[model samples]
Target chain A: MSESNTPRLPLLRFVYDGLRQMVRGRVVYWSWIGLLLAGILVGGWAYIQQLQHGLVVTNLTNQVSWGFYIANFTFLVGVAAAAVMIAIPAYIFHRQDIKNIVLMGDTMAIAAVTMAILFVVADLGRPDRIWHMIPYIGNFNFPASLLAWDVVVLNGYLLLNLGISFYIIGCHYRGCEPKLKLYFPFVVLAIFWAIGIHTVTAFLFSANVGRGFWHHAILAPRFIASAFCSGPALMILGLQIIRRVSNYPIHQSVIDHLAIIMTVALQITLFFVVAELFTEFYNETEAVMSAHYLFVGLNGHDQLVPWIWTGLGMLAIATFIGTVHPLRRNLLLLNVAAVLTVIGVWIEKGMGFIIPGFVPTPIGEIYEYMPNLNEVLISLGIWSIGLLLFTLMAKAAIPIECGALRAPGIPAGKLICRPEQQAPEYRKEPVNGESES
Target chain B: MTRYAMVIDTRLCIGCGDCVVACKNENRVPAGLNRDWVVERTSGAWPRLETEFRSERCNHCDHATCVQACPTGASHHWGDTNVVLVNPDQCTGCKACIAACPYDARYITPEGYIDKCTFCHHRVEQGLDPACVATCPTRCMHFGRLDDPRSRVAQLLRERNGETLKPETGNLPNVYYLK
Candidate 1:
């Protein structure tokens, strides 16, 4: 630290510093916002059209009612689960460097969940009637309804993350430490809740006995493993962008640490896929027939073949590129590999994951499902919104991270406090000696 | 006070899908959607194949998983009867029941409401049998009160070892199929 007698500036100068710093980062911030706005406008237009015309806008027929909406929901579950990868280390293992950065994951969780809810809304033909979901209004089926449980769990998880983010940010703004004593238990619950959202989603599909492909027993664990890869890859990509634009620099060690998690997650996902394939092909039972047919192409027309092959190809590329001696060592390549792994898993866990279960039909007929243009646009729009939300949050957060908005000693302007520090000794006093210190 | 159920004799079914078409027309079911369907499993190879058709719908299982899987209680068995119905208003279009149902009887409709054969509950309310039973050209489907010993369906069950789909799931489906 350089020794200087630079007197502390007044509140107005502090406010000016915040605005100037944001203006300097305007290129990066505005670009993200601009692209996001374009996507939302396009997506909103398509969604409005869909609402008027109904689900006919999508290629989904009765044979495939799920299509992209369910797939996106599945993908976002992985995103939500990935929040734990960061949380486990920082809160559970008490990793100090990750402590300050944990809030990023909290915000990401909120964004992921927002997208998931939006996808559900878009998937509905009559989103206006969503109020029927209100308990007792239409009828809450309770323990029998996993969807009801999903609604509860998802909303609960969202509120939990939002609460934590607000508490932490409020503390930071006020130059006080957040009261960890109160929020810690909830944080611990959020970790398990993190795992809960994905597991429940897997069970949502796995519970279908008639759909042989989805009935497999290992779906829950498979979901967790896949989420680990996709979530960390996405986070790594986000961090790389933050490092580039913001004055703050995250330790290369943090990136390397997350890379280890990506490696393990990818390996496990690959193993599960192989194991599932072996069970289907080797067993040769009528039950496994549809999965094999959809995955490897059964009766001359392999509609999903190219996409599935590409997913596997990308998986191989991700593993190889991510493992290359200098590439993993290099932040740029590591970021590239992370991007591949995320996309690869998205395809694998999205379509390759959901469609096969309905193939070969329950009685025995192969029906194909393809997403119509509107469906694609609406999905893209929701994703863009998530990115936009993350960007805005980071715009506010990155300044604090860069030390540009921080108070001289700690954070300033807010009086939030940890319980132990809430004692009279630590409370802020009047500046001109009108109040006791 | 009405209990709705169906009896299908696979031995007589010709895989014509007449019941499927009839139900759709009666229900105003959208095109490409089937509230009731016949799954034909063809055995043997090519020209020598022998096909077996099983007409399936919501069995209105005594322990219906669809009801259990519905997060919003949109799917439920009618009082003391073998009929499952969905309140469209209550459904969130989540499709959880579609996945939970082992029989593939549940379908997600264009309106995002879950749809399935309700044993023609609307018809039953009007003192009639399900349209599928009423319209079957082959007289392959029988509709009656299973609790009434005098009913043909009950007599048929006593005479034959009728089976329900995925009985092991313990859903206690009211619909019975005769081999």
Candidate 2:
């Protein structure tokens, strides 16, 4: 055998090597678990305060009914939608590189949906009365209410993904090929479910026929575009992190391909944003005037102006950075761009999304809303929970992807000692002088 | 059948906020929540600045988007009464209706049900005008049955160039404003 081509450690060995490295340094795991517990405790405390004090503790006054909770809900739903982008390439096009990463997409969906539901609970004025949304005991105004429909779809999507993911994982554990025939239907269901969540969310706003700015057929499309771009940008960043912290190998080509997807989705999103602006600005109607005032700062509320401009600026930077050469290739720059785009869209779609429509108030009063500390803390708590969920899910899933976890047909004995155990540990060591075994 | 409607002459509205107080007391609306409100606008600049006042509440829209958006069916129009009401018992307080209402007419109550102007539907059944109309010191707000051609609301619409809020939204609001 050529000396240079010495029998490289098996892929199984590479995976095991990685896991040993992670466990040996168990601080990372415990610290994350600690952080998660702290978040839940803090959040639970805040929630108790909210339950006792009512929504008054929230910054939502008579003017702005929806504050941080709704904004987070909107942002997380977009995050969930990113799964479709990954699923399209993996399942539809059957991209081999995307296959391993596909689990992250679905897993993220679970975490994102959990956060969306958390926001709903946080925003409730009477948190105890939430059960009234049930079918018979509580009047479930079906088909008509986008919110009711959202409840059904979001929960359904969550369970559907849970079932499919567990089944796939179970198959992997037992050494069997995933039953594609059984699961393909759910995949289709998930794509439509992805569209359903964001679409219903858009309809919740745009259905306001009295609010001329919201009364547009284009709102749904705008939401989808925003979701498509923001979702994948988050996924790309997540995968990049996984590759770094764990010994997982993800091709640069995959990251570049994801960037291309983000670039196109962002372009479409920007196009819709422009079109919406044009439709509102060009119209000289009174109703449209109020909306324009919120966006362009005609009334005393100039606070929204800077935020809007910042959103625009960041979006431009993200698009430019993502589309430009070498910048997109650099992991740091790419992550920054992805994160920027995600945050920009959140500000644009979260606060800018709901508040502007209420401005110039339907009756033409400018009532400015400011979120208080309680609201901010509660929001932070919810976000921490989302991250915690993502972290745990990632820990379980990364091992499977790194080939540390064995598939069917591999003998159980051999599978346990394979590269899955070594890959994470070996990667942490500097490669400068180490000999390939 | 009482087809309730309101007509307000902007020229007569002095921005007194009496209508708001009257509605609040009549409905027992909580503090910080108003069933009826008047929006004041001061436009132009310097010596030419002009202030205009508009009194608004539920339009009791003929095609109410709020009704369609309510997941619990908490929002519904009272049959043949021309009044829209929300059932607190059924409401999960999703605020879908709040976001859906263009008039900014809907509010999430402390109890978690959607709240809006009912046009004093209870008093209307007792053959009385809404508190806002009855207590309008300047008699700026006129309330009557639009279906009754002899009523003041129908006559005002026929005599004056009255406009409904957001007519282009196609909600066909019952409330009208005279400029």
Candidate 3:
């Protein structure tokens, strides 16, 4: 096979091989893929119903215009931002174990951002008219609109990750060392951009002087802290799955690093929650209407009471597990913590944050909302699409990173010019890697 | 300089809801939807009930949050009329305007564009009062240029202790309620 160190990668061949690699897995992979497709099909049907009937098919009323889809969009943005957890340690801190799997983080970000955008599309009353906000093509209200700013930052972050993933994997496929000079500047921009994406999302809510619940300063920092925990928690579970199913080497040190970051992030997030709660409750002013509704009840409407408590309970338990050194080190316990963090953040940061702001709405009307069947099905469908994208991406990438897939002439398990014995991840992989087999 | 404003004398309003009905007819607001509504707020204990019936609609604020929050320039000030409007052709129905309005003033119509009280800008172009103002049974509603101190709305605000809903929001609402 002809593997070349020439700077220009063979784009067509790389794509062809990547496509071929995705379909090479056994029954479990096929089953997983089949299940995702099934979800998409049902979701697509539900989406059609939503389109024909307009948004009325969903439980979303004018009072609660944004619900399930926006909530998922919010959660996914946090997941996408969490890629920084891996990138910072990999590139900036120069940890070889983290560096080995950092591309996986990029993969995660791409899938997540893609899903976030899709969720936004799903939420739109007239999604087809989205081009109206397109910067050059439409009358995009640039600096004035926080939603406009979100459109810019989110699309920018997605492009940044796409470029980073392409360049990193292309270098590996071409059997050459990824020169820091070529990739480092973009890597640095990406880290800040990751933080920016989540920050902008938080600001989108906080800048709304109309919604007393979301109009606070702490929401932005709180979004970041919560994002760190949820993002890494997702990565930990995904990495373990990748290690089990493929030849992708996921080291204990990598898991430990992420768990440690998540633990610290969890604590910081909890502190922010406490700080915000104190501000809302200290004097019990008219402004506490939404928070009061969320925590206790407002005029006999206590629907959201169960949800917020469950989220906090999970977050608290996860934090406790992560704090104790022995428990954090235990893989089973760590996975449990990760699961708890994901569900907790989904509830806490998703509906717990968005819905309450609109609950005891600005005019002091009490309108409660629950996602209907169409909304739930559509959400499940989009999530499946995201997981499907992530699966295929990881499938194609794991082999190249492990030196199992390269330019046609390069032998399996041989990296021609990468740095020598970089770490355990760079150790000689078995010939005719199962992924290549 | 033609800053259109509404002055509702709540002291005279009898909560008949004729203003709300007139807006629905004028705007062709979707079924079971409203551009304006009567809010009957009762304060104090049962022994002493103090009630005020205020007809609420879009403020079309001088500092309109909907215009600022709209990613597309669909929500805009209508020329020299100083009235706010949503251009359906430009609206993507992102609903940022809904969340940005403290009055809960905007809603998405079945056509999938945001619909709200436009101050009957269409009728206003003919130099006529908004449907709600003209149709009020109690003659409690007045509409005119806030910039013109001689206008009825401006005169009423100058004479009465008028209050705007959620003035604390800094929205600079053009709608004032005279208690």
Candidate 4:
């Protein structure tokens, strides 16, 4: 065995080593992967059916043109953007607790963005024609179309997170400290980019003067606040799961700190919700009918009332649990709060956000919308694909971060030069690494 | 440049829905969707009730939000005529334009591209009136070049008080309604 102090392998070899470790997991892991695969198969079948018979398969109509797919896309964008919550405190503020787990947030972001893109694909009536939105090769209406901005920001954010996370994990694998100069600027840009993804998504809705419920200036800020709440909450839950399933160290203090951030964000989100509600209810206008449909019943259509109230109720409970320090410290309660916060925000930001705008549509017509079986299955399939990607990424990354695996010739706990800065001799070492063992 | 516009005299409309049927036949709009429809707005107390019937379709605004929201330039103003039209070949069917439209006029066709009232542009290009205007039994629907002083639509606008729908939207719709 080559026991040289410096070990280097080709880029593809490193990826191969990482992927080899990914497929080798416990029985529970395999089962989980199997479940995700089943979901993907089912969803793919549903999508094929939809492709055969246009958007008529979904519950969407001319009146309710956008439905569950777009709602999920909007929410997932917030989830993708929420990675900045960890990035900001870890890199910018020099917080040590989140430093180790920040990569997980990036992993979550990659998965979330993948899902967001898939949801957009699922929602399209002619998804095959999607290349038309591509810049240059296709006629991209930049600057003017917020959808175009969304596409650019979403893809850019995905690449940024993927690059940074992979680079960090690769450095860890190579037993080297990542160059702060290279990553710091990207981290700062990611923070702003994260904010941009959700804000641009909000702009996508708000720019439409037609949808009165979404036209308010407060929508973007509200989206950010809610994302901050839900994103970190999901991360905490994920970290807790990782800690339980594996030997990954998760600090109680970090969970509590994240809970605090979520609490504040949840409170801010509620404030915005109340502000929007007051604005809608105080003066009864023609535009207020959609809001009426959301909060109350509009012209006998009361489908979304139960869901919105449930979301509000869950948000209140989550906020209360998160506020009490003792409750926040209790992992069980904290996780419950996190779960509730996620569900609440999912409902509030997803269906509650998109549907109300189209309820009493622009021409003052009420056409109720509900996702059909095909739509739900297709959505589930996309979510499964996201989860599968996340699991694979986490499987590969966590082991590297935990020092269970390392690059060729790089021993655990030993510091070496960054990959690019290594001597030519380092690149000539054996391709096989500890991951093979 | 000819700025083609439509002036619908709601006062003269009987709400018989001939225009709706004519538009569907002319545009070949799919079943369960519409390019045009009649809306009956009823107000006041039980004994003192008043109902106004107005036929509504694509406004084809000068500042068309659909045109702006379309990522692929699929929804564009038809040349200098300023009538909003969707190029199905270019449409990705993302429905961004549908969401952007204030009038709820656009719909995804069964073929998976957006479809809306095109002011019967095909007929207009051939120097014939729109199918809706031609088929209106009451002669309430009038179409002509808004920039032409001699056009009947311009003359009607000068004689009668005409208002566009949802003027607060600032879309500056080319379609006007005479009440």
Candidate 5:
């Protein structure tokens, strides 16, 4: 401690300082922020129009009640769950290589969850009545409803990640070690919670026995496998970007580890896809209609045929690149594989996953669904908000993690101590001898 | 113990869609959406074709998935009447019920809550038949209490060997089709 003591600023000041750092960035950062803001504005305008006109403004009809919004919501749930990949290895297994980059996973989770919730709100015919789902204030059919389970798990996962990240970053800012006791239990819980979130979401779809496409026993496991692939692929890409833009010491080994995880997960996801295909195609049943629409054109409606095939192609290429030792080692190829994996999973999990269930509607009516302009704009806008949030969170947390910024008590320009490096300092404090004396 | 059920004789149905129009007017359903619809199921090819006209609406099942799936008690059975009804005030319009209904009978109303065939519970309360049952030109639609053996619905079910749509789903639909 310094001889001349300076009173610490209130907790609010730390938050203000963090937010201020987000705005004072370079031209590229400003441009990115501007772009996201534009999306938000455009989306907000469309949402206002929807509010005045109701869900009728969108292309959604009674036949296909859930469209682009729910699809994105479902995909983002998996993305949120993907945080568990890093959290498990880093926190549970104590892998040092993964520890530094786990913050990025947590940050991604926060952004994805925010986007997921926004997508749900966007899809609601009466978004204003969302309070009806809130506990006590509204009737939450918890035990009986999978959607209710989803609401709990998603929010729980979000809070877990947010708390863990904030505590670690707060410790970094104050030039002290985060108490393991405080965050370790939460991290462990979060690992299970992340899995729960995705499982609950999968059950939300699968439990709908009405929708033959989603009513599969393998759905939850398939969700986890796909989440692992897409989440880590996104993390790998994000780590590469961070490594390029900042002084953060994102190790190459971390990227390699993530690639290996993605590769195995992608393989398992593909296996599940094939298994699902076999089950559906083995017999000519009414249940096969949705899968038929996905793989081939159902009647005259073939809008999604191209998209699903493209996703499959991308998945194949990504898996090939990810598996080969030399290709995996090559940074460019690895990045390409990561991008492919993300896009493939996005298509496979998003529209590709949601649309099939609606085609050949229960009454045997075939009404094709495509997102109208308003739906697209609103979706883009929500995505922009998520990106903006992630950008700001990353901007605030990264500097603290790198020791470029410190809390009020720490001297300016002093290097922040890493977790491993802080061990010796703790060891030097001879607690037992001092107590004995 | 009053189990309200409906029996629709597909053989007597003329594909006139009178029931659909009557139900729409009675419910004041939004334009471009339907509370009841007549589906034409056709099989075979060329000169030996067969077509069947079936009237479809909310099944008001013994185990209604919509009621089960509703996060709020918005979609529920109306006591002994056993007709599935939506409490507009409680509905959040989350559309979980719409997705859960295998029959695709539910639709989001202009008011933002789900709207479906309520078995004309208002008319039933007045000791009158549903608008569809009353206006059916062929008198193919029959609505009565299934618990009473003397009720027309029960007698028809016993005589005609009536079958519920998608009975394999185990929803135990109250609406039966007299083949």
Candidate 6:
């Protein structure tokens, strides 16, 4: 605490402003939050049932051990990784339009990474023993285990995004530009760290040599490609919603940039899918038995066949829309593409990818897995929690970035609250006026 | 120095299912779940059909993928014997070991830890055969140290040239099946 002429405890004041910003929102805001809270309540109760009954409550079995919880975890990791698409352009290429909303990308990453960690925890049979995965405290198998590597990278990426977002937003709140020397190096590392998080997550599935479906070398590339696809697709939809609801100015250029990234990523992702299909169906050996179950059917079972095709159909339609400049430029078509890709990737990467590997067990026995109500409710709970977290972060971040809130002592701009911040004390403070005594 | 292995003689064995029942009684495995199972595999054309009932359990591989996949070192190789075992106290029940097992040999216990065949190390320590082996109706199942050349398992491996399942996986399993 340097001795200064300014008012006492600027950090406390910053926190106070941020808290006050969160509490003050319109009916729609409260309704959105209320809906998420209801989901959390139901989800929390479902998770309790799981705790009391063990994993037996879910449809997971010896044959198909990892189910819906793991599938969602896999897909969400990509969403967390997608924040880098906005980051590279905004921070590196210096697009002012993107730079305006880059804070949103980082905030979304924080929410996503937090959700990814929680999903993994929810998947664990004994969530209490999670400390056993810690390096020094418990016996964490490093180097040898890909899962150990994933745990390290996911947490590292989370902290990296947290640090970068906090520094930049804090600078905004204080009415100053964040020093490049202090935060630029971290921003650069976070760009690479994002890719690492998705790749390591892919490796977690691919390292299982016994599960031939996920054992392919192409899985990592596919993960990155679809990450670009679904990650940006989600960003597109989220940005539009933010634009419609708030005073925050999300430029049309940001949406255009994200749509382009998603288009190229979808083309590459489809190519990779073709390559996988060729590799599986070409030579046609025992190794590709899972693909048989996935694509067409093995024996009489074809449960996943319809799902895989539907997902691909959606991706193809989205890609077609994105390829046409007029269709993509139109907000309606672009949003439609975004929605399709988001759901498409969820179906493709989520249950569609995770389940098939376990279906036709190693020695060639088909035991299908269907997630019960407990898993669905618990998963919905986790998603609601992530959305709520993102909302809180975005709510605070938008006001701070818009200069509605700031450290009281910063001499520069007027502390003009947005239309929504109508609190008695938070009435816009004059830039020329003397500091509060 | 003692590498324990199981050698099942397919020629002498009937599909009696005594081993499965004995394993259940010995280990008290959960009612719906099993530590070992009997798989009936029939191959070749209809007239030339070849049917074999295999009593399958953990392979206890030298290159144990489960041990490698386990993040907490909970699914680990037991000292000296090198039999893969789960340390329930340290297990997070992540199920990575279950995914890594080429033979689908592991299962999550009702209590939450991954459970699998231990090759009856506890009974073997007392100089007795595993309950399944002792109770085999056809005297087809054999468990002994392969490191000792004089042991029946080692001798059977020499004379019969028994094969392990999914040898292409390069897991190098200790369990052998004699045709």
DockQ of each: 0.56, 0.53, 0.85, 0.87, 0.75, 0.81
DockQ order of candidates, top first: 4, 3, 6, 5, 1, 2
TM-score of each: 0.87, 0.86, 0.94, 0.94, 0.93, 0.94
**Top candidate by DockQ:** 4
Candidate 2 displacement at residue A282 in angstroms: 5.0
- Candidate 6 docks at the CAPRI level of high
The 10-residue segment with the lowest total lDDT in model 2 chain B: B90-99
Candidate 1 TM-score versus the reference: 0.87
Angstrom error of the Cα, residue A313, model 5: value is: 0.5
lDDT value, residue A329 of candidate 4 = 60
Model 3 chain A: lowest-lDDT 10 consecutive positions: A428-437
Question: Residue B103 in candidate 6 has what lDDT?
Answer: 95
lDDT of every model, 2 decimals: 0.76, 0.76, 0.88, 0.86, 0.85, 0.86
Instruction: Provide a comma-separated list of chain B TM-scores, one per candidate.
Output: 0.90, 0.94, 0.97, 0.97, 0.96, 0.96
In the predicted model 1, the residue pairs found to clash are A141-B72, A141-B73, A144-B68, A144-B69, A145-B69, A145-B70, A145-B71, A148-B71, A174-A414, A175-A411
Candidate 5 on A126-194: residue-level lDDT in tens? Answer: 878888888888977877877777777777777888898998887777667789898888887888888
Q: Tens-digit lDDT track for model 6 on A235-315?
A: 999987786676566666677889999999999999999999998898987778899988898898998899989999999
Off by over 4 Å in 5: A1-9, A411-437, B43-50
True contacts preserved, each candidate? Answer: 0.60, 0.65, 0.81, 0.87, 0.68, 0.84
| lDDT, residue B152, candidate 1 | 83
Highest lDDT among the candidates is held by which one? 3
lDDT of 1 by residue, A211-275 (tens): 77887789999999989999988888876666555534455556666887887788888889889
Residue-wise C-alpha lDDT for candidate 2, range B44-143, written one tens digit per residue:
9999999889998999988788888877777888986657888777666667777677788888777656788998888887989889999999999999
Interface RMSD, all models, one decimal each? Answer: 2.3, 1.8, 0.8, 0.8, 1.1, 0.8
- Regions more than 4 Å wrong, model 4: A1-9, A414-437, B43-50
